[model samples]
Target: MVTSFLLLAGLGVLVVATAGVSWFMLNAMAPDVLPAFSTFLAVAVGVVTVEVFLGTGLVTLGAFLYNLSAQYSGGVEIAVTEALTGPPPANARALLLMARARRRLRTHIAPGDPGAGDRSSGARPARAQRETE
Candidate 1:
């Protein structure tokens, strides 16, 4: 209970801070770029901040519900393979597979995924040596 309250409060504080910064930036911009930039910043801040916060909330909620259910049910566990394949056709195994596959793709795009970009494991290409030929 207390933890959940704190989590929500923390999110509220973050949203306020982001909104404050966005407001300041809008006010600071000169008239020429103000309108365009302010609009852009407003949308960007709203999207990146709110959407991220919402996603965080959803993940937290999922974890919390899982824990609560586990506590009551004496625990529940599913193998990764089973989770991906689901039960059977009547249970919509194909839909579960597709959703899991999409989630795997989404995870690769998350913050620290190595394959996020085309960079070769953070290794830079060496400078080309002059050919003697």
Candidate 2:
């Protein structure tokens, strides 16, 4: 989501820069027609603004709908495993430290997982765990 916004902002900046250069050249070539260049630049900016808003809206709507559906149907699951064939590298100590930190940050259950609320076996739900902490 952040990437999408950054990409659109970059595109807008590029379009505006290109239009400014074009306007400068047009003014130099035909000073009398500067108004036309200004109008063109205005229209281009308007179009880009509309495009950015529309794209952001669609992406937000899609995410919202997906989250709504995922609540009823369990979302996707992925399993990952790391394999090392050779001996660890010289930076193995740093890697191990980072790995340990990441493990501490990891969440066992995803928010949409059905098992997330199960506390029958003495495991507290996420909210309860946080409240106790």
Candidate 3:
């Protein structure tokens, strides 16, 4: 009976470990998910950061769907093609689509985005603080 219990417990731990590894792999493959994951942990430790979880989630979902579609449709490089092409000059539709993409990214949490911070005020906070003092 003791031997049987030990076997079952080992099996349970093995199953849980396998599940944890699979979950890690899935998240690693998800687009923009790492930033959100780090942000969540930071928030738990009282650090505030804009992660744009909804935007990142949507992007990840889209990437998942795109990968699924590629498996069915002989694969296509959609994101890379869009970025490298920088919108087709002759096609108004492509330009319009690119414009919308730019606007969406601008409003969302894009890492290293220069326009991310509020720039209406001419001076940065440190300079303002010095002036006030």
Best by TM-score: 2
Residue 39 displacement in candidate 2 (angstroms): 1.3
Cα lDDT computed for each candidate against the true fold: 0.61, 0.73, 0.56
Candidate 3 lDDT tens digits, 27-86: 778855554544544443331112233334556677779978998999984453425654
Q: Residue 109's C-alpha lDDT in candidate 1?
A: 55
Summarize candidate 1's per-residue lDDT along 3-53 as a digit string, tens digits.
445676677667666766776676686445545645755665666566556
Candidate with more favorable, higher TM-score: 2 or 3: 2
Better of 1 and 3 by lDDT: 1
Candidate ordering by TM-score (highest first):
2, 1, 3
| Count of steric clashes across candidates, in order | 0, 0, 0
Lowest summed lDDT across 10 adjacent residues in model 2 is found at 76-85
Better of 1 and 2 by lDDT: 2
Best by lDDT: 2
Residue 11, candidate 1: C-alpha displacement in angstroms: 2.1
Query: Which portions of model 3 show Cα errors greater than 4 Å?
Result: 31-133
The alpha-carbon lDDT assigned to residue 72 of candidate 1 equals 85
TM-scores of all predicted structures? 0.29, 0.41, 0.23
